[model samples]
Target: MNSTDSRASAYTTLSRDSVHEVEIKRSRFITYLFRVESEAQAREHIAALRKTHFDARHHCSAFILGPDRMIQRSNDDGEPSGTAGIPMLEALAKRDTGHGTDLSDVLAVCVRYFGGIKLGAGGLVRAYSDSVSQALEHSTLHVRQRLRIFTLPAPHALAARWENELRAAGYQLEPSVWEAAHAVLHIGIDDTEHDAGQLAAFTAALTSGAGRLQPFDTKWVDLP
Candidate 1:
């Protein structure tokens, strides 16, 4: 399925790409974490890593994409079956975002450099899982909020005066569009009944019943 296909209203994702390494039994497990929106991006990242770490023995990988997490994939890359990739994927799926939201749009790849001491099935699983878990612990994360857009048209002077007031009132305003007669202020707010009511009431009061909010499509915005 497409990454944008049945998205959640809000979700958690990595703030940036990160790499964390660990040593187990003399073998190096380097975990790369990337925020990805599609399977193709995840695959591209894995391929790049394989090229960068060409000497590594194995490059096991897993990815969870889409806000709804509808696309989940893992590859063992010659590691024992169900040991490396599955555990890595589970680490991402079961990650605690502290806000109770599921983690998505993330890809984890563990490149292993053999140290001649082999980890058995259980050991491999634990090692790979720990590799991703530790990497995630060090990686920064944030939430994506889907906000509804509203446009309020007003005279340029009034728009300028109200812009600061709106910001002070905690309203999220996008850049305004200016026309000959007026300015269109783009406002973004949570797609909730309470927020809608508050915005409509506030705008009406600000304009003394002359202003009206024009609803537009929703967009996803990032929040720390």
Candidate 2:
């Protein structure tokens, strides 16, 4: 696959809502939290909770996105210097990469409820980091695959045979269409170089070297 395709192959969080909570005790100090993929989603959850518990002390948040780690932002809220947001982001970075598939985006938030106890700067960092770490341990994750899109045109009569041959050769074929007297097939190929050779062979066999294969672009796709 091309560089653009490879760069996009990183895994990302599923577009769904999930919440995880943890209780931390540092001499009467308590912290409750939730993590989501996007800042907007995280903010939505925080907004509802903040409305209900308007008196809570702090709500710290962080998020990372794209295969290249393109987007990264964190907010300490109203905690001490280097206490909440930075530690929370660090915790998420140190998290097991497997939880997010190969190339995935992740976001973490730690909501703090001061129990009338000051945990100090160091204690606050540890508490915030641990909250996210614990939540990731109980969450579900997915793996993504890179797919190359190829468009091929063959004679209408040979379309079925072409698709069957390609599938039997370990290729993923999409719906075939008949345009005039030609059959157009769309295929998805993995990153493996072997797929190119396989496609060439299949095309030669199906159209007797008369058909053409064109590869368009590559993108990250959910695994079957």
Candidate 3:
């Protein structure tokens, strides 16, 4: 399903691509964590890593996608069944992805650089899951906020002023547009932040009662 399919929920995921490496029994296990919106993005990352870590013996991966986590996938990449990919997936699933997040929209990969010693099934599972858990500990996460949009009208010059001040005050904004010689600014308010009267007051303060804020649409937005 598409991201839009999960409108009532927000999720937590990596703010940026992150990686960490661990050594177990002389074997190198590198974990890659990424925020992904769709299966396409997950596949792209897996393919790129396979190329980048070409010498690595395995590129086991697991991904959870969509705000509701409607899509889940895993691959062992030639490893023995139920060891690498499933544990990696579980590692990602069990963690607290952060506030207001449902732990969706993320993909994790365990790239193994085989050492002389071989880890049996149980050892392999622990290594893969541990690799992911450790990588998440070091990762920086961002919250996805489901936002309601309001289009406010302003003069061209006032648009810039309103944009700067409101954003600095921590309001989410899309780019302002010029329409019929006036600026149309789109402000995105978090689901919990919406208050019509408060917004009306803010709009008046910005435009001196010259224009008003009107309802638009709702979508997900990331906080900085």
Candidate 4:
């Protein structure tokens, strides 16, 4: 892949849990998605679903976690070996969040309600993958960016205007705080992105050469 595509495929996660269902030959496959920050959360979600869908025959699941997308786990949950959870996991792995990143911190579970018919291994795989894919269609995605938190000092007189204008120009800003004579504007910038020159020029023009932007910390921010 090119550098642009490679960068875009870095990290992404689900904005919320989503649900979608499908039927094949009367066999019902209900796919559920959950946003989980850790393995404990994922396990809790799976347990909750087990209680809610008590009659479900199988509750196959898969999960991927961390900012680096380093953790992954899958469970067959009583389904035929390699037929349900593996396909569900692969389905999530193949998903693109459309923000140049792979999906993470999410779990997918497929609850199967037997419909008096049996699907072979291949059919089960297709059903599980397709069910998760369908659920992802209704899921919202968030982009995760490693960014530098900055404090920009603005004249109190221009604080409101600058807040509106800077945000409108695509800068993510936190609330402004009055400190003596200036309004300190908290903002975040993706230092690794190719917007340094543009951001510098914009800040200079906005503050009329008086803006002092300083980095406070580095963190990962989620963008919808």
Tens digits of per-residue lDDT for model 2 on 1-224?
A: 34444454445453434556555563322233343456676677667766765766776777776666667777888888788888877776666756344323666656666666677899888888877777666666555667777889877777888888888877887788779978889888876567666777777777788878888777676554
Model 3, which residues run further than 4 Å from truth? 1-6, 154-175, 178-183, 192-213
TM-score of 2: 0.77
TM-score for all models, in order of appearance = 0.92, 0.77, 0.77, 0.83
Clashing pairs in 3: 12-101
Clashes per candidate, residues 3 or more apart or on different chains: 0, 4, 1, 3
- 104-210 per-residue lDDT for model 3 (tens digits): 78999889999989899999999999999999999998877777789987777677888997788667789888898888989877554435456777777777787
Model 4 spans > 4 angstroms off = 1-10, 158-165, 205-210, 219-224
| lDDT (Cα, tens digit) per residue for candidate 4, span 128-194 | 9999988998888887776667788888889999889989998888778899988999876775445
Residue 134 shift from truth in candidate 3, angstroms: 0.8
Clashing pairs in 2: 10-103, 11-103, 11-104, 12-104
- The lDDT, on a scale of 0 to 1, for candidate 3 is 0.84
Q: Give the TM-score of candidate 4.
A: 0.83
The TM-score that candidate 3 achieves is: 0.77
Rank order (by TM-score, best first): 1, 4, 3, 2
Selected candidate, larger lDDT, 2 vs 3:
3
lDDT of 2 at 107: 62
* Superposed Cα deviation of residue 26, candidate 3 (Å): 1.4
